[model samples]
Target chain A: MAELARLQADFAAAILGPDADVGGLGGRVEGDGIPAPLRLNVYRNNFRQGLGTALAEIFPVVQAFVGPAFLKAALRHFVVAYPPSEPMLYGYGAGFADFLDHFPPAAQVPYVADVARVEWAMHELQNAVEEGVLTTSALPEAGRVRLSGNVRLVVSRYPVASLWMAGTGQLPPEAVNPDAGGQTAAIVLSDMEIRLLPLEGGIKTLAETLWRDEEPDAAQLVHLPALAGRGMLTDGETQA
Target chain B: MPILKRTEASAGTEIGVGLKSQHYQDVVATSPALSFFEVHAENYMMKGGAHRRWLDAVSDRYALSLHGVGMSLGSVEGLDTAHVRRFRSLVDAYDPWLISEHLAWSRTGGTYLNDLLPLPLTTETFEILVANVSTLQDAIGRQVLVENPSAYLSFVDSHIPEVDFLAGLAERTGCGLLLDVNNVFVSASNMGWDARAYLDAVPASAVGEIHLAGHALKEVNGLPLRIDDHGSAVSEEVWDLFRHLIRRVGPRPTLVEWDTDIPALPILLAEAEKAAVILAGETGRRKAAHG
Candidate 1:
């Protein structure tokens, strides 16, 4: 009904901008030290609170980087652009990193997006299917049948791995300057956890094909991977 | 939806604890002396995966209750029949011992605040709930219990007292009441009303489950505004209210709900055990007094 929408709009307006004419909500406008404005302020606070908590949950690393105040301001911007469309609050906040990329404020911090991407990957990885991966023994005796919710990965950049390591306290406080970096490799969320290693292109292809039920006619790492490949890590010898 | 059929005189069922995922192995191993496990219906609403996997694992061992926080039962708009259908499917799949929702509404039109929002207790609103509950119950093909809310503010236009409103709801829709005692204390204290009187007003016979939790006090302009925050241990006053309530209503299924700032599993178990002690004491007293 028009009345309900008006009430919601008023409530929203009162939340976003208290000076706006927020009218016709069921609760009172005054008399108990509670202005309609203050009531709406509480709602605004809750709105911010919900999103803020959710973002912190999803990107604790990013939150650490930006700190609470910056994150809070970023979230205020996000909520205006991306109010939740569904009741399920857990699965929200997919657009923050991209939003940051275009955001003029974060222009100085260009690599924030890359860092956010890492955090988002970790977030997604947490919720990803935790099926059993290929065992070490299974690696030798296997036809590449595609591993279950599992794969091995290799990143060309050790700095990404070191950055992750530095963030996670796996490595010491050796600040990984991405500019002054040796090429890094990672396992990349393989083994159901983020692992960084030299990019192994062939075995990952075999795994991906197997995972997707595609048995490509190749016993070796046929992808001609740049840094690392999974299939038959022989010493630079091409298969006959 | 309101309950399709409920026996007011029916004996209260066994107590249940909210199922947390971490305790799956411990619960399976220990088989602790719990009456049942209540889970957020939405949590296990997934089709397959760990939520379903463990729920299936534990389903054989315990009675399950489906308590939903998202079904905006008191919304002015008609119930989301899709939600009702999903609930019905879950009910069919899980076959829970009891199903319940809040007296509060969350979604209005299409947007969802996802908080258990307060509703004005009035004749018009009653009509809305009656229709919504009836429709939801019909869709779900089962009965439902409605829990009372923790209200922060009162509406001047609202003529009906919350107790009467809730009791009236149960009467009209054939629903059971999940009497949240801490909510009662908080709402009563915040609004400056008599909680004992409100408890007396709510017919004891209509209640199916009892909920107790801690609250935080917010002094909004020196008026003690008790926020129904289940973050810490049960307050002495809330415990006192609980003792008073169960003594009157007899030993019903009670839960010590600690949602925010959830402590370790053992700490939660200890809190539940504390409630059990009170329940045991009351049970002993009743036997001595009545028998």
Candidate 2:
């Protein structure tokens, strides 16, 4: 048991680190040029490629924003720092935006991290558990409305929704300034398609606040019907 | 957990294709006449939505096989109980004919690498695997098949050979073998072993299914290293091995897995058809010999 633990630890180090000794794995060099490290390299490549590919899928907007070559290089470093802690790759890149925030190379694109956050929110929202949301027709006009599990509210200092839309080819290409102030995106699933509803003023706060179990502010009352129409309001749990 | 009395193989002598989301609409719309559709259990672990809807529609028409890649049954830390329960839920929802996981570890110490790592064929590892398999079987209330891994290298600390390990595991845990012929070919080419010997060593009655997939060839220092990338068609070499093994073990349910660079549904169907023909030929040969 101790030997197995040590072997795995060594193997992990060898695969995760560039200069770790792989001789501990006890792999003999096959033909003349076939080095043992090269055998280990296959695992290293698989580890990087596997996680990198998953990140690429979850953060296609980020990939598109920075281009593939830059994304690949960042992913090479990201894999070592934030290796997946779960077998399922769907939720693997949750911390990727934060990783990019501190990464020095991606400093030029200040909004890259925020964009990643939005993308991650969207990704999670898509896979979030689907429960029966009350239609607007059955509105309980007297209490705090609960949001469906599929609702994600992303507030970013950049127009990430538009950037994401442009990246996904939902809209024509337009110049998006990363420094163009903040925006709130209500990422909701309507008719099984992800709709990035750009929120403003009280509605944004209401959408964000409703994600948690809280009473809507007096200012948010005007936008409650709009929220309900977007299938964000669940007509359940009347507050006493 | 009730014991799953798998008296007769639900999957008869036919081939199945790994159903990918890209080909879902076409597959559901066309309703391809394949024997069954295999889906990775992890892919459909959502609470409810389009994927589930699609799977429901497809499973209504074709037989379903739930193949899991994230169970991490061989972990020394023991099987993840939460994962087992989720897996059980999937089994309950979709009563798949066959369920299988790899004979490799992907998670340890709370970290999942998401790649199948080779396990040392030692008594300690084998004992843990038996316990893990038993726990999973009890949890899922079914017999699960364990697939042989495509190893990039071997460990000197390994006491038993892989075939012996798998055979012993099946004997102790009452599990079945998912003999991935491509893995046998890949492992043979990578570690310089006789795949035929490996196949012959496996108990024929223990094999419940077979997996055929294409492998990517990587040149490490000018020597070929067969990586199980599942990005192309099954090589002629792997096909030959599959033919030989099926003839030896007789035909179990075979699957053609293509995860990356997934071709059109028609292409996957054709690969499965090829496997079906091989299985059919084997059945015919057996009947002729019996007569």
Candidate 3:
């Protein structure tokens, strides 16, 4: 058992570590016509390509914003730094946004991390379980309401929603200005489609309050019907 | 958890395709005439979403096979209890006709490599696999089939052959075997073993399912190596190997696996059709032999 564990550790290190150190582990593999290092490269390519492709799927908008080459380089570092702790690939890359925040190459593009956050939020909401819609009639006149399980609110300093839309080709690239100021976007699943609605003023406050699970004031309640109509708000009742 | 018995009506000996998310709407709408659809257990591990909805719709119209990729049955550290629970939940919800996982390890030291990493065919690794497979079977309350992995390199310390290792694992755990002919062909070619001889040696009754897929050939250090990419159609060599196995073991529930560069739905169904034809011929041959 100890020997097997050591071999696995060495093999994993040879794959995830820098390419210069494969010789040590390669000696353990049989070179039946093909060199041991070349055989180990197969696993190296598979490991990087598999996780790289998964990150590309999860953060396509980021790929669009930073281009594939830059995303690939960043992914090269992100994967080793934050290899998946679980088997579910969809749940992976939750820490990518934070990784990009500290990435030196991405320092020039200050809004890319926020863009990653928005993309990750969309990814999570898309996979979130569908919940019963909160009908307008079910709302109590003066009671607490909560955001649905499938709703995500990403408040960013930059125009994150416009950036997302532009990256998705919904809006032209020229339509978004990174310095165009702060934006609060509500990502919700309604009518079987994930919609990103940029919020402002009392509506944004109402969403922020509900997302935090706090009671909304009378002024904020004015937008309650709007949120309920979009199936974004739910009564505070726990689901069975 | 209620145990769903594998009745003959539900476990038909027909060919199926691996269900991809890209063809969910097409599959649900067209309802193609395939025996069963195989899905990666990790892909549908979510609590709810469009994936579940599409899978529910497709499973409603056809039989399902739960093919897991990340269980890491050969991990020396032992099985992940949380992953087993998720797998059990999926089994209970779908009540699939067949359930299987790879005889490889992907997770180690709490880091999942996201690829079916190879394991050395030794007694130590074999014991680990016995324990893990038994744990999974006990948790799901059903027998699980362990599939062979495509190998690129062999371990220097390994003394046992790959076929004997898998056969021993099945014998000890009482699990079935999923004979991936493409894997067999690739491993045999890469390791300089006789692919047909390997098939001839497989214990026939333990093979509950078979997989046919494509592989890509690349030259490493001027030596030819076959990589099990599963990006294209099944090669003629793999088809010949599949025929050889079916001729020996009769018909099993076969699946056309195309994981990378997935083509259109019709293209996948066409591959499944090819397997179905071969399976039909094998069935006729078996009937004649029995009579």
Candidate achieving the largest TM-score: 3
For B87-201, candidate 3 gives per-residue lDDT tens digits of: 9999999999899999899888988988888888888888999999989988998779899999998888888898899899878888888899999999999999999999998
Tens digit of per-residue lDDT, candidate 2, span A1-240: 776676676677677778425755655223334666777777788899988876887778888878999998898899887787766677678888889989999999878887788888778767655555677667776765778766777778888777777777786656666667888788886666777788887778888777666887778777777787888865443211
Compose the digit string of candidate 1's lDDT tens values, residues B27-123. Answer: 8888888777787776665444445777887788887778888888877767777777778888899887778888887676566665676665678
Model 3 chain B lowest lDDT segment of ten: B1-10
Which 10 consecutive positions of candidate 1 chain B have the poorest summed lDDT?
B1-10
lDDT of 1 by residue, A1-240 (tens): 444434444454455453324455635443366555544444566666666666766776566556677777887787656666555554567778788878787776555555566666555545444444333343434343443332332232234555656666666645666555433232344433554443334654454454355665655435423212332222222212
Q: For all the models shown, what interface RMSD does each have?
A: 3.4, 2.7, 1.0
Better of 1 and 2 by DockQ: 2
Residue B214, model 2: Cα distance from true site in angstroms: 0.4
Interface RMSD of 2: 2.7
For model 3, how does the per-residue alpha-carbon lDDT over A1-240 read when each residue is reduced to its tens digit? Answer: 998898888888888887546745766798887778788889988888888888888888888999999999899899987888889998998899999989999998878898898888888877786676688778776656788876888888899999999999999999899999989988887766888899988788999988887887888899888888778876544343
Top candidate on lDDT is: 3
Looking at model 1 chain A, report the run of 10 residues with the lowest lDDT sum. Answer: A231-240
Recovered share of real interface contacts in candidate 1: 0.16
Q: CA lDDT of A69 in candidate 1?
A: 78
TM-score for predicted model 1 compared with the true structure: 0.79
After superposing candidate 3 on the true structure, give the runs of residues whose Cα lies further than 4 Å from its correct spot. A23-26, A133-137, A212-223, A238-240, B1-12, B289-291
